[model samples]
Target: MAEWTIGGVLDAIAGVIPDRLMTVCGQRRSTFADTADRSRRLANFLAGRGLGAHRERHTLANWECGQDRVALIMRNDLYPDAVIGCLKARTVPVNVNFHYTPREVNELLEYVKPSAVIYHRSLGAKFADVLPPDALWISVDDGGVLPELPSAVRLADALVEGAVDQRISPSPDDVVMMCTGGTTGRPKGVLWRQCDTYTVSMNGADHAYAAEIAEKVRHAGPPWFAVSPLMHAAGMWTAFAGVLGGQTVVLYDNRETFDPKAVWATVEREKVGLMTMVGDAYAGPLIDELQRNSYDLSSLFAVATGGAATNPRHQQALLEMLPGITLVNGYGSSETGNVGFGRSQRGDTRDTFELRDGALVLAADYSRFLHPGEQEIGWVARAGRIPLGYFDDPDATRSTFPEVDGKRVVISGDRGALAEDGTLRLFGRDSLVVNTGGEKVFVEEVEEVVRAHPGIADALVVGRPSERWGEEVVALIARAEVRAAVTHDVLHTHCAAHLAGFKVPKEFIVVEQVRRLGNGKADYRWAKSAVLREVTPA
Candidate 1:
């Protein structure tokens, strides 16, 4: 029989691998049996508090639906339990970025209109004022003094108040809502069915080997670590992929910020075989740390990254630091999961990815698909194993998830060219493309050149309104050192050597730092503002 729901798959794996390690954090460890029991207890507790699948339309907001939504407003450590419980209870898990401001948090909560909220006690004060009165609040203690909130009940207390054996079988169509548009704009919930998400994003087991997942785990060495924040889909998908493969998940517990030393320490101690990060934003620091100190990273065989751009320079730096280690740059989004994988190796194109069978380069018109060997630029699209749609936004659902040639596809606004050899050379997001003097320049391409500079820490490329050209390309840079020997002429010379003159930045603005989202994606909105602020007269 096909395993329809995520909880069912987890249970099947746990039943076989009962004593296998499931999760490991700073001081917390859980076996498969322990994970199952805790999730069951939490599921029962949530059910008792009137949290279960409700498929009626919500009366509160026009852009709201009646899926039993459980918002998670905590750090990465509590994600596995909350996500598992939500799945087992037949409820949708909505990821809430705890880093958002109170206003942003309020906006997301209002839009999602969740039936329950599982949050860290540290954040209760930040979001307590905006929570829905009808929503059940379960607070997880972070071993810190938490502000008293009248609406919250301790998670430990709730776990003991409910039955440990309560089980509810969910259909394959049950929703698992993941919020996209991180750290910018109002968050939109991407609705994905449990089974589709599992097969497409998570590494689901074949039916023949489903019952033997434990034996596979018993033979495999080392755990998988997700270095990215779990609130984002990439990290959550990494954790799920590890669990589905019957491998233990080693979660980083540093809630403050990205600490490369601590991460290396954890990897060395746990013998993490595979680790996931988010592009060059993470790779740069990890490479710098390797240069500073050495660790027993022999157990680590592969490192994977997604959700942002990873330039070839960063890949080369990593390979230089750790020879023979595989570096994978994954191309994907919340709507289109696992579109393609780019193995960063010697002589590989910097930003190019090998297209998976289901991945396609659709014509800019979206009328037909562009075949391989077509030199025309097209939107990168994917068919088969895509999301259901954006929750509560049927219009957006129709626009993004369109049916082409009698087949459904999801186009997440990424633009790329299909090469003669069938490899896809990603140009970057069409929305962020800068057109200067009738010539199109991809910011990501230019940014890659800028970031490749040894003296530059980070860079953001934006278009500034110009009298001569329609829109001139401007670069905002963050220096690697306090007094680095980097200048406008030096950068221009570097970029000119690699790219066409029009694609080079006309002006460079030096800043203390470049803004990035928690998930390591470029804050284009912030970059645009910074460009305007610098170019405008005082």
Candidate 2:
């Protein structure tokens, strides 16, 4: 088989790798055997409920009929069995952001109108008002809350009794949808596939890294512990890469409420050899904790950072703190897999590019094949095994995967260029999306919320400098009244009504007037610089 369905992959792995220890969260250790057993039992439990293929096709259509896309609003449990279960039923998971507040959660439910939602019991209340009274809701009791929804099934019991059905296989064209695009609102789902997952591991850059790490894992314990949630692209790709290589993946269940101290303790206790992070938000806290405690971290083989740009200052500090440690700075995105080929030793070099068509070219920061006299910056494009299309959205699929002279190539929105020797230099995302920590917040979306405030006429939400969070959101509001003074506190409270926690501005800056082009277009460069000076101390 080119690639088995999500279920078949697990089943095959279980048969071949029965003795291996799979996932570790604190003291609870789940072996490959345990995971497979639980998954099978879970399948049986659902079968017992008359929810399997035994039901007539038309009757089954009553719930899933006309449903092209669905969301799996669930938390990370012992193993990601729900991801397998949903895929078995030919339903791609939306993987809704777990940090979404009740209001935001409700809005997404309205938008997707999923036939069914498999959520945690604690999250049941979050969906109470959002979901239709009769909409089918199955709360996976993660040993936390007792689910009393109309259609309730305690996961432990449900999994055991669900009947077994014909194993379904997913094709390469089938999607493993996660994050949303659209930049406007109600995020659109990004697509991936079983083949893509396997391909990411087998990809040139990733393959070399995995082989190097596997050798290290043979001599040492687990090579890495994923500090961030596996929901995001960086975290998910890194974690999955570890999984494909049979390296132990150590992750905390409570990444939603990040605790710097707990992370340190876990590192010390778990003997984490590699600590992978993407941006300055995680690096700042790690550096702070390293300073506070004189703990022995000799087991920590290296520190890898990617997903966002890291400042030279931050990179220098981290190297000084963890001398003799491998500090790798890499780059990639959800649409285009792992494009950044060069790895930074001290993390000083923010320059990134990928080997495309067997040559390293500019990713998004510089122009491709620069002319002798033409020195202007070029928008980056990676020419390689980028995805064919996005899930369900043909327009976006076309925008990213463009046709040049009838040849299709994926051009992610980020800008960059190639050097003479083909070393790729990547600029940060040029799409006007603010990556606060690891989460993406589109400026256009945030500006709409700021404009909703009665105190504002027009607004620009630009990323401001921050030592803690990689990028702090700053709203530069255009005021209508000459005497009105809009304070940061007032705007924060205003956002509590309409925006999610992550999207809300940490600090609000009042401007005499919002700078824009003659046609009311946002001048991002002007807004970015102005907000930086306004928020950052001199």
Candidate 3:
């Protein structure tokens, strides 16, 4: 049987294709052999300091982690190294949002109780006062913006040049923690076994042996450019999946912000084959860049957007500009890996996905699995190769990942319906659903119609308080230009044409920009607050 461990598979790939390019970020490039060596050294360093699996998965509860945790508070450059090294050493790597406020950072760190922290020098001050005193601090240089912590050790200095440690064994049951962005509420740590995460993240590309995977990767694919931040699951998983499949992974260099021009130039120069982005927050600017200037994107074949709501208008515009390119909209969450994906080409506008194996729609009440042709909306769910549960939250763990018909499945808050043909009609997150006058309206559905208008640049829909109706639908619109002729009546007319009368926005507030996280996911909390501030009497 295969080990099915990340370190084991990575080692096998390195043995087979030692000279293959593994990662490229700006001028820094690393081959598989070089990466493996560095990873082994880091693993050894951690192991020597007594960091490894302390207990097996079966020995601990679903929400409990027996392994030491390391918080990763850095950008894309050395992010993969930290994850690979921690896994190799049997230490769980927890993702920390670099864009988080001081209080948010402190709260997350306190919840995870990480034993060590790997951060960029630019962000040292944020963690200095909040980090656990006993935690090991390993800092990476980021233009030397902030002073280093008192007990910090440079990453380069910690690595020791030596042969791979033969005695260090990694288990398939070892945990890999992915922390949610806390956009809806407080962030919870979703924990998955190494084997399960590898299978799911690779879209169920599992083989019996590491040697089999190595042989299959003999002919490497074209380079994959990961434009999303590594702190997010979408970005980290895509980059890891690319390397595991024997493809060079290109990291986006703009650490502070997303620069579409620089991204396109890098894609042209590196000949990036597939680029991963997070919806309109990325696609809107990229479309603007493409319209303003042309680049040699001959090497680009596929552009995939995930981890957020992708505007159909942006998708169609991209398809029109890049002839013969496939626009893929991936559908999944941190709890359930890659459940389904929708593909679009030139002249195509629909956003329905064929559910993968072990994925289906549960009844609205979650009493049973809904079969194809179910007219009622339900929760989108996945059974096999799912996470163990959210760490340290037994109640949430049981509620999110429950047993149905004697089978364990994870329903990650997505509301959708199954078509007669078995395609999934996703209706955004259930948390974003607005109930107006006893009618449930999916915000994504309304936002789609509003953004389709030529004058609108982007829009977010939320429910605000109302005297008559339980809650009234409200839209926050950002125009394409300051002087663009976008009004509440114009948007209402456009939305009314495509949607039911109740789904139309009752009120519209023009804003400079729609609130979004660094990873392009909607900031619902921000939107709701903005709406409250606007509607509340002064």
Candidate 4:
């Protein structure tokens, strides 16, 4: 069988379905032939500049990389091109959060130590002070009026100057670095071999050879729309899944903010069959728009959400609006790729996933794997085709991906227990657990009950330092409207019936908006700070 590297898969698919549409972003659309050609040109350009793999994976430590790193700091439009090109050249493409502050950007860049940086020209001024002196800079046009970097090469010029006919070879061991959002702490790069990534994230497990996969894609599938930023793992995985399946990948166009109307219009115009989003942060707005306006959404067959806790109420509302559509709730993270998934049934409020192959719940003591009907809450983990380790952080890599019974597994930090029937009963992240008055409480349990309230639009639960108790749970809520009939007593009564007394929040602070990361994961750091500011006396 051919090696399952992303570059090899791309070559096979392009060879078979070169005329099919590969990507669509607003007025921009590219065919497999065009995208493959452009990617080859970019690969040649970077290779000519002496950037490629310097050593194989076996020659380096788990926390070390010998490939030239290229930081991608642009939006979703040309992201596939950049990644494919880097892979073809045997270089690692690092994802950069474009919404990060200058300091955060500097910290990430310092850690990754990329040999090249590609960013949108509109962001040139943001990196002027902190950009490394030795790295090559390339800028893409975002149709914005901003000063260009003096040392950066325009992406257009580089593509034209690049040679198109050079032979390229990419190894399966080439690394792909995915950086965590760093909401709780500093961002860590999770490195995965390209072949393993393809197996775990790109449906490589279903086929034995790249030629067979390409032949299966003789007819184009319906377009898959990515409603989240590609810098994050959820969005990137979903988009690449479409590409590997020979489906048209549609990117959300509005970069500054998510415009629900614009998203639906694009879906309608493109006849998108599948749309992926990040839980309720994106679902709530889209639901509100659907209630206010009418659009032809007959083409949309499935709506998949992951990367955060999805509210079941929102899922029900979406199902009611679009009958006969499947609502898929996926479970996975950067460390564990595509662990499991569950579909939302009509009138069901619980989100439970069936563990995929190689996924199991580890015992609380980390000594062995748990069996079906295990009563103790354990850590959710995946054993095969997982990431290598956190880049340059051996301590974290060892802790997160420990060996149990001589077998390596990636612990996803999510606390869950196996049911008698062998399905996973997922709880909130164990890292975010709160201990108040000697009782451990999962914040997600409280937040789930709070969001079930009719008046609550969104909410986040966090722990704050307390005098009587070691730490107290506090809730930050965003109401559906300013005048919504949501009061402390009403929420307290609602939560009291569904949760243990200790799990209930001590106070609920109403906020205009609940802050979230660009990819819609809960910003626990922001929530903790907000709670501190609200409770502390000036």
Candidate 5:
């Protein structure tokens, strides 16, 4: 396989296939030629503002000082060009979650110390006061009531210049940082070399397979839609895969919030073939929308989910709605890209994912890889084509990316077991594992059972402080129907049928909604806080 940089591969593909449609968002569409030409001009635009890799900087109080960073805080619609332009200019593109509060935005910018920012006009207010005074700002129009940012350059004005390709040569080792927040408090940037990320997560094809993938896209590729926010690693990677394969990429144009009906309408209009979403956060609403109205969904052949766990009930519901459609659950993270894929059948919708090459189960001590049929639950890990480490976080990098048996591997925080059939049974993150009365219970397992209840819309389980037991399992449930219908006794009975007695929720906190992160991940921190504040007796 010939090593390929992100910009190099994109340019090579664009040069060969210039007339192909590259992206579609609402009323706007860009072909490969337009994307290439516009991105090149944008890169030149950024470079003209003195944003490039070679720009030296004074060492900050504690942060590393090198390579100019360009923060991206926009939605999925205009994300590709901003990212591609940054890469073409050899500038690091840092992901900024737009859902973050102003304080978080300020904190993240202080930590990242980016010299430039590309943000949506709708989100300009969030960073107007917090953005670095010297940062070069460019705002993309979102056709909304936008805040005034006097110092920022309008995207249209920037793109008015003549098309000129950036001649900057980017090394395969150029850094592409993905900012992610987990159960841990502060967000950390996971750093990956462009080459490693390309091969690992970006649907990289080797010399032997590149032509085949390109040809397939050229001949029979369907329009691809990433329903997840582009700020998320999975969302960006999924959309980028479309560009790599020379397929038209589609994004939801609605900026206010996720509207399932709007997504369905876009699919019908665009004839989207492949749609990617982040688990039940998206699937649950989509299911409700399907039940409410009839949609012409024959064009959608596959729906792939990742970045969060997809409950079996939702999978079953989707399968019932769209018979003969493929439902795929991609299990991996920013650190370990596309490690495995779980396919759901009509009746079998278990969370058992088939392991991809380089993925394995690690023993409890993290000393050796567990062989197939290992009874003990262990950490899911991936070797080969993994990220270098968390950016500027040596301690975290050392802990997450450890060398075992003379081979470096990424220890994804997920806990699971390896079946005798060589499939992995994921049991949520290790951090969320609960121990009550000396019995260990996986939160995801119990949550899955709770969500299966007909009246329950969504659920999150966390450990609460208890006098009798060290920590008791507590469930925070979202009631979709009558709250009385989803009684504690009823949910307990339902859970008891699928889970062990100890795994059942000892306490239930009913709510109208369950909160999720920008990437559709369960906000464990929020759950824990809510349980302690509301459920715990003073």
Candidate 6:
């Protein structure tokens, strides 16, 4: 493998190919030529705003150097060129979540202390303080309300000037901070180096998935539909892969809400072949949308759902809804690149598992088995692609990323076990254990039963803090609006059909919307907060 940098990859792609389509945003599209040209201009624009010059040369001791960071907060618009600009100007792009409130956004900015922050006007206001007080805040309106940042520069104006290719990388190992929240309370910034995140999107465009895409969009570059958030590697991988692997990227501006009807309609209308999904959220909604109206889906060849533990039932329902489509549970994280994953054949999993060096497994005590060399099952460990551990948090790095048996590995904390056939069978996350009267309740089993309810759109299992029982099992459900079909009594009766007596939630709290962070993950902490706030004692 060659030493890869973001700029290096771009240069290689530019050398091998030109005039290839890179991105498709609604009616607009950017060719490889366009991306390169615009990135250079954006870099120049960024540099002119002192993002490169930085108004000073900081010294480590006596030797002075420029160490500027440029942050980005926007939804998936399929414009890798903007990200590419950070590499050019030796700037690190710290990801800012658009869903974050002003307070949450400021915490990220305080941690990064970026020199310049770039954002699309669509989701940039509350995140204004994510940059340092004295830092430059740049704005780009992709047809939205443009916030007035004091030193703001328009991206369109920069692109109007001629673009020239030039060097713009600090180091291969320099951090490009991308933030994602987890079961933990606050969000942890996953920082990727210029060389760390390999683009597997270009291994060979003749593969089955790529070939299927090529068959649909035979015009120019390989086209991919962006479904996940731009901050997530799930979305970034396809976008970059499409660019390097000869595909055009089509971004679905979902605007933080997953509307299955609109997504399927776009896929059929624009002829999207490859897209990403995150577990049940994508599959279930697609299945739900099917009952509403039938849409043409012959164009879609594959959809990779990841990020969370998916039940076999939800996986089965997805396939039942849309037969003949390739539904794969492709697994990976911010720290791990494309590791070995299994494709569903019979009921979410009937296919045999091939245990590679790094396979995910469920441990005996509801812990993640990361690595097991000799025909053993454990949590999946892909230390090879571990992100620069939770930016600025040494304690977290120690806990999550630890050295076992001499080599450093990332402890995913997901539970799974190994089969004799050398495949990892993931169960659920370690933190998802529900304790009730000293008995441990795994949420995966409970969620499986509760999600089976016909009227339930979504369900989450969380333990409510109890003074008497230690922690009581509670379920927060997002039920479909079917004229009061699912009352607490009805759902409790439904759970009795599948779950053990004690595993059933002690109380049911119904809500119009289920709170979730990006990548279709349930924010259990917030859900618990909401449940605690609303629930009354008997």
Clash count of each predicted structure:
0, 26, 0, 0, 0, 18
- On TM-score, the candidate that comes out on top is 2
Instruction: Write one digit per residue (lDDT tens) for candidate 6, span 396-426.
Output: 7776666655556666665455656666666
- The list of candidate 4 runs beyond 4 A from truth reads 164-167, 181-184, 206-208, 348-350, 433-538
Pairs of residues at least 3 apart in sequence or in different chains that clash in candidate 3 = none
Q: In order, what is each prediction's RMSD in angstroms? A: 10.4, 5.3, 10.3, 10.3, 10.4, 11.1
What would the TM-scores of all predictions be? Answer: 0.79, 0.84, 0.81, 0.82, 0.79, 0.70
Question: Which model, 3 or 5, shows the larger lDDT?
Answer: 3
lDDT of 3 at 227: 91
Q: Per-residue CA lDDT of candidate 2, range 1-538, in tens?
A: 2434445555555565666776676566776567667766654444333333222223431112222344566655543666556555555555677677777777666666565567778777766677655444567665554446765656665664554544543344445665654666556655555455446522312223323433433432564687777666677667656654555677766524777787778878878888877678788877788788877677887777767766667888877887767677766676666665455455454455445351223323332434322344555554444555654467777766665434455666665555555566665566778777877778787788789877787788888767777787888877767556667777887886777787898877667777889887888888888876764311
lDDT tens digits, residues 294-365, model 5? 989899889998876566677888999988678998878777988888887676675688988799988889
Determine which window of 10 residues in candidate 6 has minimal summed lDDT.
56-65
- Off by more than 4 A, model 5: 55-65, 161-167, 208-216, 348-350, 432-538
- Model 2 ranges off by over 4 Å: 4-6, 41-70, 132-136, 142-147, 201-223, 346-350, 353-376, 535-538
Query: How much is the lDDT of residue 41 in candidate 1?
Result: 84
In candidate 4 the C-alpha lDDT for residue 439 amounts to 41
Give candidate 1's error at residue 292 in angstroms.
1.2
- Alpha-carbon runs more than 4 Å astray in model 3: 1-3, 161-166, 181-184, 432-538
Two-way TM-score contest, 4 vs 6, winner: 4
